[model samples]
Target: MSAKNRDNKNRWRNITVGFRVSPEENELINRAVALSGLPKQEYCYRRCLNQDVVVQGNPRVYKALKTEFATVLAELKRIEAGKGVDDELLSVIELISIILGGLKGEDANGE
Candidate 1:
């Protein structure tokens, strides 16, 4: 067998998911991950590993939701530019997350 095949057989079999996107989308995704202070692949891997994440959704709808989330986060920053996390704001964030988490499909359950 090939060295590549031997290596593949020895490694853990993580399921693969692929994407097809234009260069612009790739750049945007890279920027987003960088802004989060994580390497691009690490960001993707952590997101994939996190069972609490909403596993499946309509891509466009998910993108729209994420866009709106960024907008809300920006609004919070403007409101508290030099301040730390406010208790009320943190609670709101948690509530929003819980609502969003409910929108996911079930394949991710108990992961």
Candidate 2:
């Protein structure tokens, strides 16, 4: 058998939890996970438990931020003529803002 896995608290993580999400929801979750620089499972559990997903600045996170910024710029260009923005895009923007704010030693409310 493969080696067992344990969390930081030394508890065995033997339980298997699964759920289904629509394509759009999956995309959002994946994006959030990438931005948070946390493993998908950890991110999901933290979010489910209403715990904070503290972001630490690292190369992976920096790359994700760069990629997301490019995407947002493209979408903004496409919608430059006062077009309605997709809610998903707005959500991404909000997430990026929060991450950036934290990196700058600011809170979610920019304080």
Candidate 3:
């Protein structure tokens, strides 16, 4: 698809912008977002806007955790810029969520 065509489908288009990074940074960025399995543009857009693309949160804890995740995810954004987290962090987050009675390996919204 053309860049212009793709742009039409991006619901967050109002907030997203694109730019190029160095080849080394590009390689790293691609690798990171691949791990999270979210598209790079979407991930970058959310990070730039400081919003959670995945709105999984416990209503009771969500406001807090989502904020925390947004922050952490933002840090992850800096580390990888919409790429993804280390497996260790992913495991830890999931384990904590499961232990806290959230369904492991699934959307918090039950999707």
Candidate 4:
């Protein structure tokens, strides 16, 4: 390899950083890394650098919940159009609306 290319490749990631952790802290760190769905080193590097880490939910569960809200949405539309909806159904639908909004990562007030 040319001297410049060799130097460039070597300099890309030449730093090594590490610290000791207690058993409890190690377990917690492992759990966090797993939850992040990233490799342990990458998770630690991102966290240490204070980068925003977005932990998304399981795709299957998210999709399932969204699908479940479809029925509630239809009911809500019916209620909005002057159809009689029971008090219990209305309450449940309201709650579901809140939950669906939250799942979409919006604030309770839809901000």
Highest lDDT among the candidates is held by which one?
Answer: 2
Any runs in candidate 1 off by more than 4 Å, and if so which? 1-17, 50-111
Local lDDT at 39 for model 3: 70
Supply the TM-score for candidate 3: 0.35
- 48 Cα displacement, candidate 1 (Å): 3.2
Q: What is the per-residue lDDT of model 1 for residues 1-111, given as tens digits with 9 covering 90 to 100?
A: 323222223864355568788996675565445334444555676777782323233564466457647856886887777756655445445534554555543232522
Name the weakest run of 10 consecutive residues (lDDT summed) in model 1: 1-10
**lDDT of each residue in 1-111, candidate 4, tens digit only:** 323322323555545678999996785566455444456766787889897555556764455445546756887789899999776555545544555565589975798
Q: Model 4: what TM-score?
A: 0.43
Query: What ordering of candidates by TM-score runs from best to worst?
Result: 2, 4, 3, 1
The Cα local distance difference test for each model comes to 0.53, 0.93, 0.53, 0.62
Per-model TM against the reference: 0.29, 0.92, 0.35, 0.43
For every candidate in turn, the CA RMSD to the true structure comes to: 12.6, 1.4, 12.8, 13.8
Error of 1 at 96 (Å): 18
CA lDDT for candidate 3 = 0.53
Residue-level lDDT of model 2, residues 1-111, one tens digit each, is 557799989999888889999999998999999999999999999999999999999999999999999999999988996877999999999999999999989965678
Best by TM-score: 2
Instruction: Give the alpha carbon lDDT tens digit for every residue of 1-111 in model 3.
Output: 333433545543343356979996675555444433457776676667797645334453444445446655666667675565666556545634543354244556654
Better of 2 and 3 by TM-score: 2
Q: Rank the candidates by lDDT, best first.
A: 2, 4, 1, 3
